[model samples]
Target: MSNTKDIPFSPPWQISDLGKPDEPKVTELAAGPAVARFAKMPIVIAEDDLVSRTLMNSLMEKWGFKAVVTKDGHEAMAALRAEQGPALTILDWMMPEMDGLQVCRRIRESGKMVYVIMLTSLGAKENIVEGLHAGADDYLIKPFDKNELLARIQVGLRILELHAALSARVKELEKAVGQIDDLKLRIPL
Candidate 1:
């Protein structure tokens, strides 16, 4: 398979169209009050341990995200494919049916703009490298700091915003190029 991209833009239907923005819901936070609301990104957290799952799910909500708690990789994949499934995903390394590494690889192969974050107990350098090579956008040790997790999530959100911007630009460029081609064809040359 060639690495070259003729038109690497996302499918028209899949493009993140920011048109007709959703009505903003005003919510008060402990830190402050009143601000414009943006679309809450769907965060898929695949964790088998009940305690951990509940903790992470609540944390994600506290950090302003819609969390889909899945007990296995299959469930995680299903959530990722859903219409409401946004690009950010958090996968626990150990899960039944399939492991996080496998899920990450599959997500990468599918090329759906999904960001896979592997949260595992393994802290070895080799393990970290392996997870990243297997398509994990980020990897966190099991006993992660809540603040750190939120920081990482913010970084991912910024990257996703950039992706949507680029995708929109691609569509605009395609239209402009098409118009130029049509004009060229109209002229006698």
Candidate 2:
């Protein structure tokens, strides 16, 4: 195999396209309130292929995300395990020192409420099922359309946000129940 760094990458879309008058710019679309809510949000990208990793990093950064790029599953896992780690991650199926599936399983076993997206060239039915079974929240094939990838990422962010909101609500309900129990204890029978 050739050195990943030596591999050339030509993205499906060009940065110049963003400036074209006939089409809407990514920045323009990302200026929405929803985008602002996720702006600069940290996200993990684990891809062994240099081209894919570079492309994902660029796209995530363009979309107002702070991408934490990793070359292998081990590094990805380390990033995910860090203090204040990102809640969203994109992982390629094949990688060195542990595949995406292993990382997914580890994440699940660790009981982290993370949103995982499997980005790989494996588009077969079984591969998709396997990835899902391994705890990937979403699966996207390679040579992916930037717009579609962005949409999927947005969905993951929304899901994470909802999870956070639900957790907070659960805590509030528990606190209220505890207070109610205390009140009941004080009341005369």
Candidate 3:
């Protein structure tokens, strides 16, 4: 992990070095367009109520994200572990299998940096504090206007972007430190 060189540009077996010398550079041509045409990343939306889930899904899709709708917190957790998971989750506070608070706790315990927004009917100060304590990045009370919901989500996305940038910077610093160590090792005593 200290070495960025160990991180491959493409995984083994993804491309072959055994190709003909004059193969027209097919791999680069194919990959260039594929990466350019990448689809919108998905967002997972968990709401037990049918109407609420549908509304959330429609809103998320309208915002140019692929939305996965689930009626239970447990199901949403499973989706989170799936390959190519959503970068963010919008959770309703009340749900079967497990409640939103429990789900948020589980997500935090897993130590993955997935953005979470808890949409609940409970608007009291204590309730908001509890949600924040349970690891919700944003808390939205029920009967919230669509504009507010979008605005909060926009804020969450910005926060997530910031987190990603910070992570990258940390990785870069670690790599630089490793290089310095390597250079020191090569120096005479």
For model 1, how does the per-residue alpha-carbon lDDT over 17-79 read when each residue is reduced to its tens digit? 322234332232321111112225577889989999999987866655567899989998888
Model 1, residue 116: distance off in Å is 1.6
Pick the winner on lDDT between candidates 2 and 3: 2
Error of 1 at 45 (Å): 0.5
> Whole-model lDDT for model 2 versus the true structure?
0.78
What's the distance in Å from true for residue 36, model 2? Answer: 2.2
lDDT of 2 by residue, 81-119 (tens): 872523789999999879999999999999887899999
Q: Distance (Å) between predicted and true CA of 167, model 3?
A: 1.1
Residue 116 of candidate 3: its Cα lDDT? Answer: 94
Give the TM-scores of the predictions, in the order they appear: 0.79, 0.82, 0.76
Q: Candidates' lDDT values, in order?
A: 0.73, 0.78, 0.70
Cα displacement (angstroms), candidate 1, residue 137, comes to 0.7
In TM-score terms, which candidate is top?
2
- In model 2, where do residues sit more than 4 Å from their true spots? 1-32, 83-86
Candidate 3, residues 1-189, lDDT tens digits: the string is: 455333322211122432333433222122222122111334678899999988888776555445778899988898877734225788888787799999999999998778899999989999999999999999999989877776666566566555655676777789999999999999966
The count of residue-pair clashes in candidate 3 stands at 0
Kindly give the number of clashing pairs for every candidate: 0, 0, 0
Which residue pairs collide in model 3, if any? none
Which scores better on TM-score, 1 or 3?
1
